[model samples]
Target chain A: MTPAVLIEKLQKRYGTVEAVKDVSFQIEPGEIFGLLGPNGAGKTTTLRCLCTLTEPDSGRIEVSGISVTEQPRLARQRLGYVAQEIALDKVLTGRELLQLQAALYHLPRAVISDRIESVLSLLGLQDYADKKTGTYSGGLKKRLDLAAGLLHQPDVLVLDEPTVGLDIESRLAVWDFLRRLREQGTTVLLTSHYLEEVDVLADRVAIIDQGVVIACGKPSELKDRVGGDRITLRIREFAPLEEAEKAKSLLQTIPTVQEVIINSSQGNSLNLVVSPQSDALLTVQKVLQEAGLPTFGIAQSRPSLDDVYLAATGRTLLDAEIAAAGTRDEKAERKKSMR
Target chain B: MSSTMTSTKASLNGKVAVAQTPSSANPVGDFFQETIALTRRLFIQLQRRPSTLIAGIIQPLMWLILFGALFQNAPQGLFGDNVNYGQFLGAGVIVFTAFGGALNAGLPVMFDREFGFLNRLLVAPLSSRYSIVAASAIFITAMSLIQTAAIVAMSAFLGAGLPDALGLGLVALIVLLLVVGVTALSLGLAFSLPGHIELIAVIFVTNLPLLFASTALVPLAFMPIWLQWVATLNPLSYAIEPIRYIYLHDNWSLNSIVMQAPWGQVTLGTALLILLSFAAAVLLSIQPRLRRSLA
Candidate 1:
């Protein structure tokens, strides 16, 4: 079977900034694919190029085997896109908005009402169908947007950051809905900054950083590939930088300890990667005590998706996000080139 | 195109993965479906809000009553023989109100762009993006005519009197033509401009100046020679002079002189022809811009 979505050598530049540089990925039919990245990592740009909203500077994107740039209308027919920001007309009621979406996708007049009813029920929007969307909570608004996207019953559903700023319950509800979609054989592709969101929903994940896909695989497989047991320790709730650095150097000398870094953002905690040591947590606590340092907190766990990110990028995902948010130039943001 | 999309769907009614490889894809049918639905959305917006439509109707009536009173005591024969200020101001108010309404055709589109609602439309599988442009033109033209009807009714009640049925029809046609041109230009701006603020600035700067320079307010004889040239060149004046001719004259004909411009005399027929050419020219000139943005 043809891949539901394929993007190769994708690159988009707004002036000197290469928003999507050499990014490529493909999703098999019925698979949930996630493009995981930080805020300025170009996930949205890649989705835009695939959806034909913005032309890529250089890339080949296919939806159900249709070239997005060559036969955009046909490609669009095969893809349903829900952008990161939900764009509902406040004055339009939920039902009316769906009707408009139905017409836009060129649904036959005869089948439109049936399709609308099915989607409304699927999203549990029956009770709010007649109510104007301005009164909807964030959850209801997102559900309505999703229903509109699915009305055409596209082969693939592409979402950009499906659960940003949503309440936990709403986020889970969206995730459950996506899982159900995959069960029904609809291919799914989404971009998300939330690590757990991708880990939970995507069958296969791609880690995008600075417009490049640094890693892609099943979540567990990627984590195992970067194999290590993890330990998080802190000298105090807010350890001094000098103490954290000293602990980092001392931990580095241990045979069981593979690597250590000071996580300054998290109250100067120390994150360590140790080769499968059963007493890794106890070893760290003993070393701290030996150095006249008090262990405020310590824990051991298996590697997480964040460890895969850390192994490749030398920084945690949260740290990358903080750095991106701080260093985002307002002028450059202005020139980010919206469609 | 078929070479690119090879999804072999047995049915196209419900599943749109390939969007009707239905053996008979009608582009015209798809265009009409989307355009009508989009136009319906605008009408629904008007029905729910109603405030903008209310203000639009009330504002023109105020212009008629207040402006008519402002010139009520003018000397006789100042505008024309046996013509009252109320009678002369009726056409100006109608034409100017429609012009203002037409100029605002882009405001909603601009807001959509700013708020990302347009992105939804952009990513959809539209048969032709011109449907978006067509919808705005239809909605604005209909709005201009509605406002025109309200003004004509109020002017008649104010003792300005009504024209014959044919005259009224002609008034609607002139307004429709002018609105079409201005609406096209405004929609072009909506797509080309970066955001809503810039589009609003363009509307603000052009709104009153064009009204003042046109024959909407005064006859060509009342202006200086340079102003007469400006008024004759103004498209709004062409729409106004014809409708004004229909109102003031009982035996109106196509060849009847509507205004004496600085260049030469403009008959009712010449005024309409000029309006026609203006509308056609604007529609053609803005095509490239619309195609760039919508394509």
Candidate 2:
């Protein structure tokens, strides 16, 4: 069967910045495919290309069997796009906006009213349907946006950071709605920076960094591929660098200890990766105890998605996000997104 | 297009087809459905927020009253044979009001872009992007007619005299041509400008100056030789002159000379053609820009 959405060798550049560089991925039907990355990772650019909001510099993008570059209208017809920003007309009520969206997608007038009602109900937005969108809270606005995107019954719903600024209650509501959509067999392609969000929702995931797909597979598969059981030990609530360093050196001597990282951001917590085995955690504890390292708290678990990212990219996702934040030229990115 | 639409259905047939319809595959039907729906949206916005319409009507009436009064006492025969200053000013006000309103046709779209509302429209499978342009043109033309009707009524009440049935018809035709051209240019600017602030700045700079430079404020005869030439050359003059003729003369015909510039005599028929060409030129000029942005 043709993939619901296929993007191959996708490349998009904004001026001198190569926003999407040689990225490629295919989203199968009936699964939530997550594009996980930091802010400037070219996720938005790739989505823009797929949505036909921007033409790719050179790439193959297809919605169903329709090549986006060749027949954009058809691709658009099958793809429902909920942009990162909730872009509702303030003067228009929720129902009015959905009605307009139905029209733009060319739903038959006879069915438009029903479609609008169904979508609003599905998203729990019926309460706010007649109220001006300007009066909506952030969650209501997002729900309305999602309703508009789904009003056309698009085969593939392409969402760009759907729950970015939503409150916890609203975010869970959105997540539940997405799961229901999958149960109905609609394919979902979403971009998110939240590690837990991707872990929980994505049936398959692609971790992208700097315009490249670093890893792609089931979340469990990717996490296990990094091949280690992890230990995060805080010698104290806020361990000093000296104590954390002393613990790190002692823990490294264990033959099962594959790697050790001192996480300064978490109050100098020692993050250890040991060969997967029943006694790896016990072995590390015994080694640390011999060196007089007091373990205020300790936990052991399989490597997480973040560990996979760290193994592949040499820095933790949070650290990369922080570095990217400092270096990102927001004014420049705004100009790129403007068109 | 057929394969694309069908492929989506085929893959999701197992369970997602719950929403499927018997006639889901018709592209032509869907296209019309969407375009009409999109057009209806603009109408709804206009209905709910009638301020733009209200303001569009009021500004022109104010122009007719205050501006007409400013030149009310001009020498009796100065404008033309048997034509009062108020009569002469009627056409200018009609054209100017339509022009000003048309000049702002892009404002809504510009605001949509800034607020990311255009992205919503862009994401939809619009049968043709031209529908976006068509919707704005339709909205502005409807607005121009309303403003024109008000100006005609107020001018007639101010002793400027009414046009004949045929003359009134000509007035609408002129308004349509002028609005179509100006709306096209405005939509082009809406796409080309970086933000609404920049678009508004362009509108502010271009709006009144174009009105003043044309015959909207005064007739060509009272101006200097160079000014007369400039006014006659202005596209707004082409619209203003013929409508002005109908307001002042019930005996007006296509062959009647409506404006005399330093360059030559411009008949009512010639003026219409000039406005047509101006509309066409403005429409053609923006195609590449619109295609780049909208495509």
Candidate 3:
């Protein structure tokens, strides 16, 4: 079977800036695929191209087997887009907005009402359907947006930063809702800057940076390929830089530990990468104890998605995000997204 | 959550199964459905917030009452044979009100674009993106007609006198043509301009200048030679002159000379044809821009 969504060598540029230099990914049916990237990493640009909102300068994008560039209307029928910004018509009641959405999607009149009812209830928005959307909280508005996107039962649902500013409860609710969508056999593609969100929700992920896809695979597979266990050990609640350096030096001498770095942001905690061993945590504790370093907290686990990003990009996602933020032109970006 | 998911999954499967057969769908039927639905949205907005329409009607009535009184005591026969200032001002207010209201048709669309609501419409499988344009045209035409009715009534009450049925019909046709054309231009600007601020600036700069340059506030002969030439070329002149002729002349025909321009005498039928061409030209010019933005 054809992949639910496919993109190859996608390239787009805005004036002098190369927004998406080279990116390629394919998402199979029934999988939750995540495009993980920092703010200016061209994740939104790629999604815009796929949704046919903006045309790419070069490359192929397909929905199921339909070419998005050649047969956009047909592709649109198969794809549902929930934008990062909640685009609810505040003056319109929830049901009215859904009704407008149903018409825009050309959903058959006979089934439009029934479909709207189901999606509203599915998102637990039945009680709020009659209320004007301006009265809704952020979570409710996002839920209504989701309902609008799913009203036509699209084969692939595309969302951009689905839970970017949502509270923890709302974010978790969105995660659960996405899982339910996958269970119902709708392929989902989402982009996010949050590594933990992608790690917890995406079945497979593509980590993009500076207009390129650096890594793509199942989250667990990517983590495993990074090839080590992470041990974050705090020498004390707020260890001195000298103490952290001393712990790093002592920990680096062990045969099992392959690397040691001081995480200054977290009270100068020592982050260690060790070769796979059953006694990795015990060995680290013994080394710290021998150095007369008090272990305030310590944990060891398989490598996380962040470690995978770090291994590929040489910088943490947060650092990339802050750097990207400094360089982005908000006005230009908004203009690009508008049309 | 698990139980709800299970039940939803079953129903969703059923719904998808029903929607899978796309072969029987009718494109033409779907286009109308979407257009009507979109048009209904504009009407609902107008209904809930009636301020725009209310203000639209009241503003023109104020102009007629205030301007008519301002020029009421001017020398007799200064405007034309046996014509009161209110009589001449009727046609101008009707045309000007429609022009002003139609010029604003893009504001809603611009707001939608800024707010990201236009993306929602763009992402959907629209039968033809022109439905957006069509909906705005329909809404503006309806609104112009209502405002025209109010102005005509107020003008008649102020002693301008009502036109005959055929003349009233002609007045509406002229207003419709003008509104459709202006609305197309505004919507085109909405898509092409960067933001609402820029769009509003254009509207503000264009609104009063166009009104002043037209034959709305003064007769063509009453102006300086340069101003008369400018007014004759104005599309608003074509719209205003014909309606003004039908209101003043008890016995009028297509051959009736309605305007005395420096170039030549413009007949009622010629003025209308000019208005028609103006509407067609604007609508055609915006086609490429609409395709670039909407298609």
Candidate 4:
């Protein structure tokens, strides 16, 4: 079967800023594909190009074998995009909004009502169908947005940060709904910064940073490829920089320790990557003790998705997110998204 | 609910094979369906929050009543033969009201852009994005007609006198022509402008100046020669003069002289032809902008 979505060398630029640079990925049919990235990482831009909302500066984007750039309408017919912002008309009620969406997608007149009803119930939005959307809470609005995106049942559903600004329960509800969609054989592609959300729901993940796809694979496979266990240790509640550096150097000398970095943002805690060994934690404790350092807190865990990102980008996702957030021009972004 | 849900889900799943293909067989049918649905949404919004319509009606009535009263005691023959200032103001008010309404046609579209509601429409498999333009034109024209009716009725009640049925139909046609062009220009601005604030600023700067430059408030003869030239060149004047002629003359034809402009005498037919050309020129000029933005 043709891939559900194919994006090759996708490059998009907003003026001088290259929003997407050399991004490529292919998602199989019926797979839940996640584009995991921090803010300003060009995830939204890639989705926009695929949805034919914004033309890419250079690239090929296809939906189910139809080229989006060459035949946008046909590609659009095969894809349903739920943008990061819920774009419902507040004056329209939930049912009325769905009706409008149905007309937009050109759902058969005979089945429009049935399709609307299915999506409303699928997202548990029946009771609120007749209520104006302005009165809906954040969760209800999101559910209604999901309902709209699913009305025509396109071959693939593309979502951008589907759970942002949602409550935990709503987020979990969305996750469950996406899982059900995949079970029903609808291809799902979503972009998210929430690591666990992608790790838990996505069958395959592409880690995007600074407009580039640095890593892509199943969550477990990517984690295992990083090839180490993570050890986080705090010498004190707020270890001094000098003490943290001393601990980092001492930990680096250990035979099993592959790398050590002092995380200054976390009160100068020491993060270590150690080669897999049953006695890795014991060895770290003993080493600290020998150096007359107190271990206020310590934890050992298998490599997480964040570790995969770190291995690829030389920085934690959180650090990249903070650096991205500081440099983002919100006004320019809003202007770009407006059209 | 659960049973309905289950049946719907089962049916949807059963038809998944067919659903993968495109659903639209008749492009024309799909176009009309989407356009009407979009048009219906605007009407529904107008129905729910009637404040805009309410204010739209009230503002024109105030212009008629207050402006009529302000110039109520003017000398006879100041405007024209056997005409009260109220009679003179009726055509101006009708033309201005419709012009103002059409000028504001972009606000909804601009708001949609700002709120990202337009993105939803853009992402869909619309038969043609021109339907978005059509929906706004239909909605704005409908609104302008309703306001025109209210103003005409109030003007007749205020003793300006109603024109014949044919004359009323002509008035509607003139308003429709003007609205179509202005709405096109406004929608073009909605797409080109960065945001609602900028669109609103353009509307603010252009609104009253266009009204003042036209012959909406006074006759061409009452103005200075340079002002006469300006008023005659204004498209709103073309729309106003024809309606004013039908109101004043009981036996008016398309060839009846409506105004004496500095350059030449313009008959009712010439005025309408001018209005038609103005509307066509504006609509034509904005096509490239609309196509670029919508594309």
Off by over 4 Å in 2: A234-247, A264-268, A277-298, B1-32
Question: Candidate 4, DockQ to 2 decimals?
Answer: 0.57
Question: What digit string (tens of lDDT, one per residue) describes model 1 on residues B1-295?
Answer: 2333235432222344333442235778889999999999999999999999999999999999999999999999888999889999999999899888988999899888777788899988888989988999999998989999999999999998999999999999999989998998898888778777888899999999999999877888889989989888889999989899999998999999988888788999988888888889989998898776688
How many Å off is the CA of A252 in candidate 4? 1.1
Task: Kindly indicate the candidate among 3 and 4 with the higher DockQ.
Answer: 4
Assign candidate 1 its CAPRI class: medium
- Per-chain TM-score of candidate 4, chain B: 0.93
Predictions in order: lDDT: 0.88, 0.84, 0.90, 0.90
Q: Poorest 10 consecutive residues of model 2 chain A by lDDT?
A: A102-111
Q: Whose DockQ is greatest here? A: 4
Q: Is candidate 2 or candidate 4 better by TM-score?
A: 4
TM-score of chain B of each: 0.93, 0.90, 0.94, 0.93
For candidate 3, lDDT tens digit of each residue in A156-251? Answer: 999999998899999999999999989988999999999888999999999999999999999999998999898889888998999888888888
Tell me how far candidate 4 lies from the true structure as C-alpha RMSD in angstroms. 3.5
Give the CA lDDT, 0 to 100, for residue A5 in model 3: 95
After TM-score superposition, the amount by which residue B225's alpha carbon in candidate 3 deviates from its true location, in angstroms, is 1.1
Question: lDDT of model 2 at residue B111?
Answer: 77
How big is the positional error of residue A223 in model 3, measured in Å on the Cα after superposition? 1.0
The C-alpha local distance difference test score for the whole of candidate 4 amounts to: 0.90
Instruction: Please give, for residues A98-194, the per-residue lDDT of candidate 4 as tens digits.
Output: 9999888887678788788878888888899999999999999999998888887777999999999999999999999999999888899999999
